[model samples]
Target: MSSSVTSPERKKIHPHKFTLWVAMGSIVMMFAGLTSAYVVKKSQSNWLEFPLPKVFWYSTAAILVSSLTIHLALKAFKARQMGRYKNLLTVTVVLGLLFSVLQWMGFGHLQQSGVQLFGVGSNPAASFLGIITGLHVLHVLGGVIALLVIFFRAFSSSRKTYSPVSIEIVSTYWHFVDILWIYLFIFLSVV
Candidate 1:
């Protein structure tokens, strides 16, 4: 048999990884649609603009730090430093929770200032801000759940049986959400 028959021309990508990439691509498209609509909607005279709350600034800092922590956690996992990995995972969860809380506080701030999400007085801009950020929060919550599963598994009886696939998948998704939040934060901040 020829060597070409015995071996493929190129190694195949992992299916799970390929699926993740597809999902991420879809997410990018969805957000692009949203922001584009926002841009178009903002041109109307009814669009309302307001200063984003300072808590959002604080939340952005927290989320950025969380992304760094998750990167370190992945490294620790690869090093087989179970203790460090667990600790880092816990920290990431805390940070994720803090980010969501801060986002909720931002909503409260907007409401207190009379920026309603939906009403006769609510403008498209305020609605877009609320809907976009709210969707991002839900995605962040999903990431937090995945982190918790990984965190618990790290301490379970099967701790000796390390599966990099699950960890890697979760980490990839977590990083995606972090990047998504950063983009949304910048987008909302600008227009």
Candidate 2:
């Protein structure tokens, strides 16, 4: 008789992983279509030229900070440092909220700066900017909700036994959203 310890074949995937991947892929496609349209429409005629809002730079910096905080939180979770993980998660959540508020203020600043979005079919560029940022804001709001869910979950006793996969997934999604915003900001700024 052959005395060999055979390892079980690894299962292909859990259902949750499939769902997460599908969601991520959908988000990628949505942003890709938006950016492509932005590029195409920007090349056309009669686009208004206005100064980009100063608040945008502040919002970018806030998002970068938030990304770092979430990364630290992930690392802490992996290391089993529950205290540090909680602290970092709190900071990341705060930063995400701050980014949203800054983006809102940026829109207000644009209005105050006499950058009209739409009037008499004028300022097409401003209108596009509003639309793109508005859509981005909606996505960011979703991210904030995701973060809140993660935050509340961390407080539950069951959370101690839960795998860090959900937290990691949220971090990945948040970072993707942040990078997308940065790309859109740069694209709008230059064009």
Candidate 3:
């Protein structure tokens, strides 16, 4: 008698995952460079000083709450709770939009607070804050787009199997952005 062993098939790396990770890594490096510059510029002499906008604190809270909503949506998808998943995803999207709008308002508030991005024509500190937050806002917009894509995909026929994976990936990306914003906010506000 001859016995044969069968090996289980390995899952291939989805192209979307690779692309998403590459995008995320690029974003990480972008912020890394911005924050490093911020630190270095903050140490320079005669830096123009200005108070952080209070709206940023509100934006931070909104992002944090959105993270929780996305997390719960992922959990609901895993548990096959479609209604809960949809509700949570909707809430997450709303929160994300609110965060973006608040960030824009925060920028306006900074302007009102007399925070100039250049000091007497040449201040690195002012430029640092403006550039860093602007870049962060751009990335957050990208994240919002990714979340919208996932939300639409969730309504398809294969929703049960594929929706969870998409939601998980989008949630991961969203949470990363949220955490990045929190870090930048703290660094800018306190350091």
Candidate 4:
């Protein structure tokens, strides 16, 4: 009797998600260096201190809410509840936009409070704060774009497959940015 050939299926890595991970790893390393420098620079006598704006707290809340909505959206997608998924995704997108607005408001507050972002009057403390947070916003923007793509896809005719990979990957990223902001906020507030 001829034995049937058996071959195990190899797990295929999602290219977009794989690229995101690699990019995130680079981001983590970049932030690590920035924070390290921040710590070292904080010890310097010339390091000027500034209070973090209250609007940042608002942004934090908005981002946290977005995280929840995205999670719900993912569940909805997995359950094949397309309508609920669309609504949740829309809410998440709105929340993300709100978070960005709040962050901008916080930055404006910083400027109003005399924490300049550049040139002559700029302090190391404020500079580092702006740089780190701005970099994070760039990543968040990327996530927002990804979500928007997913959102549009959900509305398209081809959405019936309802695969959870893309949504889950973006959810991971959204939560990462949320947690990263919280960590930075606490770090700046304390140190």
Q: Which is the leading candidate under TM-score?
A: 1
- Which stretches of model 4 miss by more than 4 angstroms? 1-12, 157-159
How many clashes does each candidate structure show, in the order listed?
0, 0, 0, 0
lDDT of 4: 0.88
By summed lDDT, which 10 consecutive residues of candidate 4 come out lowest? 157-166
Model 1 spans > 4 angstroms off: 1-9
lDDT of every predicted structure (CA atoms): 0.89, 0.84, 0.83, 0.88
Q: Estimate each model's TM-score.
A: 0.92, 0.86, 0.85, 0.90
TM-score, cand. 2? 0.86
Candidate 2 regions with alpha-carbon error over 4 angstroms: 1-14, 118-122, 157-159
Runs in model 3 lying further than 4 Å from the true structure: 1-13, 118-122, 155-163
User: Quick one: best lDDT, which candidate?
Assistant: 1
RMSD of each: 2.0, 2.7, 2.9, 2.3
Task: Give the Å shift of residue 5 in candidate 4.
Answer: 12
lDDT tens per residue, model 1, 43-152: 99988889898999999888889888888999999989989998998999999999999999999999999998777788798899988999899888998998898888
What tens digits encode model 2's per-residue C-alpha lDDT throughout 89-145? Answer: 999889888888998898888888888766764477788788788888888888889
Error of 1 at 116 (Å): 0.9
Give the TM-score ranking, best first. 1, 4, 2, 3
Candidate 4, position 66, lDDT: 94
